[model samples]
Target: MMITMKQNSRAPNAITSLDVYLNSLKVGVIVRTPGDFSAFSLNESYRQTGGHPVLSLSLRAASGGLRKDPKPVSKTVPAFFANLLPEDKLREAMEKHHAEAVRPGNDFDLLAALGADLPGAIRVVPSEGSLAVQPVREEGKGKARFSLAGVQMKLSVMKNTGKGGGLTLPLDDNDGQYIAKFPSTAFPGVSENEFANLALAEAISMEVPERELVEKSDFAGIPEDFDTMSDGKVLLIRRFDRDEGHSRIHIEDMAQVFGIYPARKYDGAAYHDIASALNVAISPSAALEFVRRLTLAVITGNGDMHLKNWSLIYRGDGNTPALSPVYDLLSTVPYIPADGMALSLGGERSFKALTADRWKAFAHRARMPEPAVLRAVTDTVALVNENWWQLPERAHVPDRVLDRIDAHIKTLTPILTSCANS
Candidate 1:
C-alpha cells in the first residue's frame, strides 16, 4: 500500500530540529525529523520515537521519496515516539503501562510518500516502470547501508568524534569524488538546499566542489537494478573534505575551531574571524571576498546561512584555504517558520531588521576591498534577479515567498548602489 498525505498538509515549515538515533551496536544511525516533517521509526526498538535521541541527523540528505509497499503490513506506524526510559527503570514499570509510552498513529505514515521515476545519466529504467521501497533491512556486516539512483553506496555506522557525527565516507565513482556527510537528527535541510545552490554558484563562476545528487536504495534486500521510490529523492553533493587522488584535508566546523562548542554560541564566531584564520598565499584576499559573498547571500534572501552551514576546505597539498562552495543556500524566510535568517547579518539577528548600510559595513569589516565587494554583490544580484525563481519549473516553493524576496532585493538596490559607486 502506497500511502499519501494531503498535498500541502505535511509540508515542512522552515525545518527547525532533527534527532539522531544511533544503534547501540555500531555506526548504524537513523535521523528523525520532528515537528514540521514529523514521523516515527519503522524499526523494532524499545527506544523508538519517544526515547531520547542518541545522535543527530546530518542536514545534508534533503528529502526522500516513497515507493509502494510491496508487502503486507502491521498496523500503521506511529506518528510520534518517546525516548526510552533507563533499562533498569523500564523493568520495574507495571506491564500495562509499557505500550502507553509509545503511542501509535492511525493516519500518519512515512514522512516521504511520493513515488518517483527519476532518470540518470548512466542507465535506463528496467522493464518494471517503478520500484517499491521497503524498510531498511539488517543484513551482511550488520550495517544499515543503502544505494540511491543507479549508484551503489554503503552507509556504515559512525562513531561521534568530539566535533560532530563521525561516520564519514567517500562518494566517488568514475565521474568524480566527493565526501558524504551524516549528521545527527534535527538538522534543517541545510545540506540538501546547498546542493541546489551549488549549481547557481558555479553559474556565477564561484569556485566550488564538483558534486551531484544521488537517489536512495537498498543493496541486499533490493533486487539488482530494481526501481526505487526513494531514488532521486535526496540531494547528494561532493564533499570538499577530500580532493584529487583521495587525500583528506584538514577541515573543522567553525564551532569547534573557534571553541564555541554549543549550538547556541555559533553566532559569536564572526565571518572576519574565519577569514583571518585562513592561510593567505593560496587563498589570496579570501577574507574580503567572503564578506562580499556574504552580503550577496543576505540581499538574495539566502536566510538559512549559518555557522555549521559554512566551511573552509584546505587543499591536501597544504595550499591556501578557500570558502567551501555556497552550500545550504535557500530563501528560508519563505519556507521556514523562523521568519528571519539563520546567522545574523551585520550583527542584526533577524532578516527583517537587516539594512543595506549594515550589510556594507559587515563586508568592509570582513576586509573585502571595496571593488571586489561591489563586484561580488552586484554580480550575484544580476545573476539571481535575472534567474533562480525560473530555474525550477515545478518546485515546492510558494509564489508569495518568491515575491517577498523580490521586494527585499528591491529595497537592497539603493544600498548596493552606494557601495558600487563608492
Candidate 2:
C-alpha cells in the first residue's frame, strides 16, 4: 500500500512532517495530523527493494502475505525514533534549550532539532511541503552538537586529538567515536565502579567494547558546572555502533526489537524472551552470548540489565543482526541495597535463587541445547572466580567502593560455588 504525499500549503515551518531515511535511502514518512496525532508509513519503494522494515514485526502486513503495505504504527513515536531521543532530565534540558513550547505530539520538532548526529543509520528530515531541514548551527568551540539517549548525564566526544591533547566534544555536527561517562552527582565514584566491572567482564572473555579511565584534567571542553562536581575521572566507553571512521552502524535495543515501550523495559520481559528474540531475529550464537552476559551479571552484583541495556547490531548486511558488545554494566547493589534483577530469569529474579535446574529450563524456553547452556554457566562461574578479585585495583576503583562490591560478591559466592561444583 504505497501512499504518495501530495503537497499541502498549510504545513508548518517547525517540521510538522519528516521524511525518515536509513543510510541515505528514504524508508518512510512521519507526519503529525490534526488533534496532535502522529503516524509513520513505510515508503512503497523501500518495500519493493525487499528492504527490512524500520520497525520490524510491529510494522508489517496483517494478511501475512508477500506484498508489504504501509501500515500506520500505533505508537505516536516509533520505537526506532523514540530510542534516539533523550530521556529524563537530559530530555527536559533538550526541550528547554530547543523547543519548550512544542506540544506533546510534536515529536517531529524534537527530531528536527537533534536528529543530525543520532545513533544508528536512521536520519529524520523534513518532507516536501513541510519545513526544510533545520540549518546547521555555527556555535562556539567546545559546544556539543550531537545528543545521546538514556537518562544518564553523559557526553559524546572524540577521544583522539592529534597535537592538541584532551577530549574534544562533538561540536559542529561531529559524529563522536566514544562516550565519556562522568561520575553521577548522586552516586559517587560511579565511573570507577563501572570501569572496574567492565574490566572484570573483559577479563572473563566477554565481548565488551574498548574502555578506559579518563581524567578530567586531561580532557578539554568539559562544562565548568560538571567539572566542579565531578571527581576528575570519567569512564571513556568506545561506541560499538560506530566504526573506525565514525560512521553509524545500525543497532537496536531489546525494547525496540520487541516493540516494548521504554517504561515497560524492566517489566513484561524476561531473559528467556531476550534469548528467544535473538534466536529468531539473529542467531543461536547471539542467544548464547545473552546467557553468558546474564551469568556475569549475577556474579558481579549487576541488578540493572534491563531491556534497554541489551542491544543487537547490524553489521553492514541488511539481513543479519548480532548481539552488540556489553555496555551499561555495573554493580547497582552497592548503591541501592534493595535493588533486584531488572528482568526475571527462568521465572526467578533473585540472583541467589538461580540454580542449575532453572538455567536448564531457561535454555529449554529459549530453544537452546541444555548441555551447552550448563557448560556456559559453569565455565563463566569458574572464570569469574579466577579473575574478579584483581579487577578493582587494575581498574583503579576506590577502596571504599571495592569493599562494598566485595561484600556483595561474597554473598553470591556460595551460589557460584554450588553451580561450579554441580
Superposition TM-score, candidate 1 onto the true structure: 0.49
lDDT of 2: 0.71
* Best candidate (score: lDDT): 2
Error of 2 at 274 (Å): 0.5
Q: lDDT per residue, candidate 2, 1-422, as tens digits? A: 22234443221235667787776667888876665556777787777766664435344444632334334454356665776777776666555444333333345556765665677766666676343322332354333435577877677788656786678666535688888887777777888888888888888878889998877776776554234464657889999878988667877788877677666788958999999888876778878878888988887789889988988777766446778889998888778777778898888888778887678778888889887777788788778878887655445766677777887777876775565544
lDDT of 1 by residue, 1-422 (tens): 22122222121112122222221211121232443233322233422332222111111122312221112223421111111111111112211121222222211121111111100111111112222222232253111111121111213111233654333321111212333432212323333444545655666567766654443431122222222223233344554543454333434344433434223333656655555454242253666556656665666667645555555544433323456565555555444535555555556755545555555565566554546656666666676556555555214333464565556667655555555555
> What is the TM-score of each predicted model, taking all chains together?
0.49, 0.86
Residue 98's lDDT in candidate 1 = 19
Question: Candidate 2: where is the Cα deviation over 4 Å?
Answer: 1-13, 52-76, 99-106, 129-145, 160-162, 222-228, 392-395, 420-422
Q: Residue 24 in model 1: shift from native, Å?
A: 29
Instruction: List residue ranges in candidate 1 displaced over 4 A.
Output: 1-139, 144-195, 217-232, 278-284, 367-375, 387-418
